[model samples]
Target: MSAEKITAEKRTEFGKGAARRIRREHKIPAVVYGHGAEPLHVILPGHATMMALKNHGYNALLELSLDGETHLALTKQVQIDPIKRVIEHVDFVAVVRGEKVTVEVPIIVVGEAKPGTLVVTEASSIQLEAEATHVPEQIEVSVEGAVAGTLITAADLPLPQDVSLLVDPATLIVNVTEQVSAAALEADLEQAEVEAGIEKDAPETEAAADSE
Candidate 1:
């Protein structure tokens, strides 16, 4: 993963009002901290940061040019508005080359399960300890021709060179099960309704007969 060059300005202002003012100017307030160094509060170009993150994923490597010094950092977290989905604040962790960092990589399932079998994913992402500069964007799991009763666990996942799993080897990742038939699905729905004390409406003729 190549680092993106982004320029940042040191920010002395604090509080919500200051943050809102920064956002209004198309900049994002961010803090960089790690390696026993004091947290550096700064402002980053909003558009450039968004574009870099979109191209590089959440664990993006950034070359932050602050003042006259350059700092290597990794994106640790981002706060976004739930309604607008726009980034509000960012947390950056300074890192050095050749260091290992723990991160969660997304799990992607590829191909299809065996006919009449359904593939259910139990884990959406896996925890890994990988080189900070070489963290994988995602991991792929192939389920092609997997039959019912097949189980793929964390230990079974393939890892990139130098990457190690941080999760338990016995943790379940994917499970293959027999697909439920339409009749079976309907029966299950009916059973759930009965358990909930919901009664099916009678036909008009049956209601009239009962009235009589």
Candidate 2:
């Protein structure tokens, strides 16, 4: 992964007022912490940070230049304004080369399942251990021509030589289920109502008893 260079300045103030002032200046408040070191609070350019994040996501490698020193960090979290959608704060975690880290990678389903069958995904992301800089944003699984009852498990996924699955091998990720017809659905709903003691032709039992 290519490193994205972003200039940062140390933050001296704290609280909502300080944060608002920082945002007013078109800067984002961020904290860098990891590797069991003290957290460093800094300010980053809002627009550039946003753009870098859009392309690389949380795993984006940042070349943070602070106080004439550069550090390699990964974006951990970002808080954004609810209405404005502007970034409020960001969290960065420092990392070193060859360090193994756990991250959730998105799952991608490729191709269509068998014509009449529908594919249901039980897990949208998979957990894996990979190099901080080499963490994948997403993984693809091919379901081409997969028919009903076909289950894709974690063990079935193919990963890069450097990546390892952290989840259970028996965990089911995707399953192919047969689609039901409208008539079949209606019949099932009717049966469910019967089991629940409800019927369309039923009268008001309390009213009839009082009249009798």
Candidate 3:
């Protein structure tokens, strides 16, 4: 991953009041911690951080400059307000060169399955261990002309040399199945109703014979 350079200021104050003051000045409160080091609390430029995170996603590497000292950090977690959808707090974890980290990479399907086949994604993302710097933006799964009953498992996907799947080999990621029509759905519903009638009458008939 490429490091996105951003300027940060050390936060001296704490709590709601301090956070509000920082935000009012168009800044965001953030913390960076990793490698057993003490967590560094800092204020980041709201607009710049927002833009970088919006484009690069949660796994982005940010080159944070706090009081002229630069550090490489990963965007670990972001807390957002439920109603307003504004970021409340952010957590960054420091990463060293060649360090491996497990992350959920988004699954993307390329090309269309066979004409009559419907692609069912059993998993939206796959977990993998990759170098911090080489972490892929996303994993692409090709379904080009895949026919019905075709399955794409975790083991079927291609990975970079440094990346390894952490998910089970037997895990089903995608399945191409024949699409069903409305008539088929109606027929199944009718069959289910007939079976339900048989089940519902057996006990009633036995009770009537006992009464006779």
Per-model TM-score on C-alpha atoms: 0.90, 0.90, 0.87
lDDT per residue, candidate 1, 142-191, as tens digits?
Answer: 99999999999999998999999998999999999999999999999999
Ranking by lDDT: 1, 2, 3
Instruction: Give the Å error, residue 2, model 1.
Output: 1.9
* Candidate 2 lDDT by residue in tens digits, 54-80: 888657889899999998888778899
lDDT of each: 0.93, 0.89, 0.88
Q: What is the lDDT of residue 197 in candidate 3?
A: 83
Model 2 C-alpha lDDT versus the unseen true structure: 0.89
Could you tell me which 10 consecutive residues in candidate 2 have the lowest summed lDDT? 199-208
lDDT string for model 3 (52-165, tens) is 888787587889987778988888799887997877789988888789987888888899988988999999888999998888778899999999999999999978878999
Question: How far in Å is the alpha carbon of 43 misplaced in model 2?
Answer: 0.6
lDDT (Cα, 0-100) at 92 in candidate 3: 88
